[model samples]
Target: MIKTGLYFGSFNPIHVGHMAIANYMVEYTDIDQLWFVVSPQNPLKKKKTLLDDYHRLELVNRAIGDDLRFRASKVEFGLPKPSYTIDTLAYLSEKYPTHQFFILMGSDNLESIHKWKNADVLLANYDIIVYPRPGFNPESAEKYPRVQIANAPLMEISSTFIRDAIKEGKDIRHFLPYRSWDYLQQMNFYKK
Candidate 1:
């Protein structure tokens, strides 16, 4: 079975940090491919500046460009609101039975993953690959044998920082992936 890694994120604007992690996971690890699963907004809770689902997906596509090793997945778009990890995993597993799906997460996220919906079930069913993040450690990962901490390079960049910079009229072209910055600018997103 092809080993694929699913990197779930809102990708408010696909930044260099997100791209670097995906690239590292795909090229340096056993994962044959990585999918940037662009998370959709929970309709009940309206985030002030969160871009539209399709717009965010478009940014992810531009970030990934023509790389065959990476794909922008919208699996959660057709699913129920308040996307749950377990549900998405079940749906993806059923839809693509030929591929073995693994969850990619940051150390911070792993530390608090038990609080997630059906956390136990999700842990028992699929493997999780944790990458390093600033100010967080994956100490809790030891509790799950399927969870492996990877040595992906530390990326200090964050989409929130980029958004704030744009809103403040700061030039953040290089902070985003190729073509993504231009799109964000043209659409005047996050520049209130």
Candidate 2:
């Protein structure tokens, strides 16, 4: 059976750090494919700086382009607004019954997992892979036995930083994938 790991996030713009974690998961874990599930809107976050959902999805596609093992999915776009992980997981479970699903997230998110809708259901149904984020502690996982911490490359890049650089007219050439950077420049994304 195929082992598919769902890396769900706002992915406001697919950055190198995100790719690094996905790459590391496939390399070190049992996940055969890592799908970037671009969320339409995160229930906990204010939509102040989020790019258009399709644009963000396009960025993810540009970042993952041609990588057979990596895929960009707009699964959340088709789901209800303020998308919850539990709903998405349930939907995917029925759609891809042959593949085993795992949730890929950062330790930062793990800290707030209790706030998610049906958080307990998510934990009970699927395995979770949490990666370290700057200023986020992995020790919190000790309290959650079902969560596994991944030893992925530690990068300090964040979409907030990237957006700030763009708004300030600074170069983000190194933060995003080359293709994504080129696409952003060509499309004038995040220039406002």
Candidate 3:
């Protein structure tokens, strides 16, 4: 069976930090492949800041490039809005019967996972790989036996910071992938 880890996020603009984490997961874990499931509308976040779904998807494709082990998925885009993890997982399972799916999340998300739809079903069915985030205690994950704390490099940068930088006329070249940066520049995204 294929060991596929699903890393779900809005990826308003796929940044270098996101790339680093994806690279780290493939190199350090038993996961055979990592799929970046770009969510159309994150249930926990406001939609006002999100770029168009297709734009964000194209950015993700550019960021991943020809990496064999890394993939960008638009599964949620085809699904209903306010996409829930449980629904995505179910859909993925049906579509890829030979793959064992896992959830890749940050400690911050794990801290409030209880608020997610069918959180218990998610935890009970699949393993969770939790990466560290500022102010988030990975130890909180100890209660869940299936949760593994990974020591990936912690980059303090966020997409919000990147968007704000673009709006403020700051250079954010070092924060994003080259191809993605080129597309963002060509499209003049996030400029006020």
Give the Cα lDDT of each candidate. 0.88, 0.89, 0.93
Query: Which tens-of-lDDT digit does each residue in 14-69 have in candidate 3?
Result: 89999999999989988999999999998888999899999999999999999999
RMSD of each predicted structure: 1.7, 1.1, 0.7
TM-score of each: 0.95, 0.96, 0.98
User: What are the clashing pairs of model 3?
Assistant: none
Q: Which ten residues in a row have the lowest lDDT in candidate 2?
A: 136-145
- Higher-TM-score candidate among 1 and 3? 3
Best by TM-score: 3
Give the best candidate by lDDT: 3
Ranking by TM-score: 3, 2, 1
Tens digit per residue, CA lDDT, model 1, 28-103 = 8889999999888643336777899999999999988999999999999999988888899999999999999999
Q: Judge candidate 2 against the unseen true structure and give its global Cα lDDT, from 0 to 1.
A: 0.89
The ten-residue window of minimal lDDT in model 3 covers 134-143
Q: Write the per-residue lDDT of candidate 2 for residues 21-41, one digit (tens) a residue.
A: 898999999899999999988
